[model samples]
Target: MTTPNNTEHANIAVITGASSGLGEQFYETIAHRYPDLDEIWLIARRKERLEALAERYPNIRARVRALAFDLSAASSYDELSSMLAEEQPVVRVLINNAGFEREGLLRDMAPKDILAMIELNVMGMTMVNRVFLPYMRAGSFEVITGSVSSFAPIPWQTVYSASKAYTRFLARALHEEERKRGVNVLLMSPGNMNTEMNVQGTSTGKLGHLPYLDLKRETARTLMMAERGHATYTPMLFYKLYRLFAKLMPSALAVKVTSIENGDTHGR
Candidate 1:
C-alpha cells in the first residue's frame, strides 16, 4: 500500500471507520475545515470504500492516506503502529469513529455481532486511545463518538448503550487528564442520525423519531464545542433534558423503564 508522500512532518488527522456513516462525515469535516493539513489518514476494513471516499476530495486526495484495517481486530493496531513508525506523521487529530450496534433482544441478536459491539465500542476504542496518546501533543484534538443512550440504560441496545456509557465516562476523564497537556477531547453524544448505523440498528422505540441532526451541522457543532474545550458535547436541548431525567431516576427503575419502553422495538 502506498503511503501519503512527504508524511514525515505532515500535520495529519487520523480517522477510523472512514468507509461510511458518521466516520465519512468526520473525514469530510476535517478535509474541508483544515485544508492546510498536510495529510488525513482514513482507516477502515474496506479498501475500495476508502478509495472511493478519497476520490471525493480531488484537490487533497493525494494527501489523504487510506489504510484498510478493522479496528475490532487487535492485529490491526500493530498495523497502525507500524505505519506510524514508517511515516511518522505529526498527528493533529484522532477520531475514534468506528463502532456499531444491533437492533434486537440480547438473546436473539447474533452472538458474533453482540461480541463485536463490545470489542469495537469499548475494548478496541480504549486501546486505540491509549496506543495513540504518546503520539499526540499540545493543540491536538480527539473526538470519541458516543450517544445519548450512554446517559441511561437502553434495553434491546443493552450492550451497545453500556459500551457508549464506558466511552462517555472514559472520554470525560481522559479530557481532564489530557487537558493539562494541551490536548482537547470531546465526547460527541448526538441523538439519532440518518446514517446507515442508526437506520439499521438503534432499537429505541421511544426514540424512533429521535431528531436526527444534520451531519454537517452536528459535525461543525462538535468541532466548535471542542475548540471551546467542552468535554461532553451533547447536541440538542431535548437530549440534555432527557439525560437529566434519567439521572433523576433510580438505577433499578431506569433499567426497568428502559426495558419497558425500548425493549419491544425488535417487533417493529
Candidate 2:
C-alpha cells in the first residue's frame, strides 16, 4: 500500500474487473487517455491474469499495481480500504465494472449464482464507490457500467437487468450529487458485446442475433463522454431507440417485449 518510490502522494485510476472484457479495455485505454495518472490499480479475482496484463503492457507511463480482489467477498473491501488509508492516493478515476450475469429462469438458476450476481453487481459496486469516493477530488471521473437491459426487466436475465437498473439509478443520482463537488459520474449503458463473459458466437436467441457492439470503440467513447461530464452514455442507435421505447411503453408491455426479443418466451 505504500506509495511507489516513497512518494507522499500518487494520483491514480482504479479499475475493478480488470482481468478481461470491458474492464480490461478500460485499463488499456486509460493510461493514454489520462496521462497525468501516476499509477493504475487493477483489481480482479485472478492474480495471475492481473499480473500477466500488467506485464503485457510494459510501455505504459503510469505504474501498474495488479491487486487481485474478489469484490463479492467483504474482506476484499476491507483490504482495499486499508490500502487506501495507507497510501491515501488522489483517485483520478474509478471504474466500477466488476459484474456478471446468469442468463436463465429465476427459479432454475442456482441459489448461489443469483446471490453472487446481486452481491457483485449490486452490493460490490456500491461498496467500491463508497470506499473510493472520499479519495476522488474535483475533476475526477467515476464511471459505472450499466446495461441496456436495465431499461426494462428481461425474463431470462432477470437478476442482471434488475441489478443494472439499480446501477443506472444510483449513477444518475450520484452524478447530480457529485457534480456539486466537481466530480463527474457517468452511467455507461451498452448493449451486448462479444466479451469473455458474454460470447455471442454460440447463440440461438433473438438477443444473440442483435448486432454486437465494438468494444474498443465503445470503451473509448465512454471515456470521452465521461470527460465531457455526461451523466449517461448508451452506445449504438439501436439501444438508444430501445431506451426510448422502454420509457414510452407500459411497464408490463415493455417487459413482455423484452422477454419475446430475448427468446425467453418460446411462444408461451
- Candidate 2, residues 98-211, lDDT tens digits: the string is 987777788887898888889999999899988898888888998999989899988887888899899999999999999998999999998877776567676667776777
CA lDDT, every model vs. true structure: 0.79, 0.85
TM-scores, all models, native as reference: 0.89, 0.93
lDDT of 1 by residue, 1-268 (tens): 2233443476788888788888899898888888778888898888998988877878763388788887888888887777776766667888888887765677878898888888898888887787676677778889888988788887777888888899998998999999998999999987777665456345456666457778888888888788778888878888888788888998788877665344333210
Candidate 2, clashing residue pairs?
none
Best by TM-score: 2
- Model 1 quality (TM-score): 0.89
Candidate 2 matches the true fold with a TM-score of 0.93
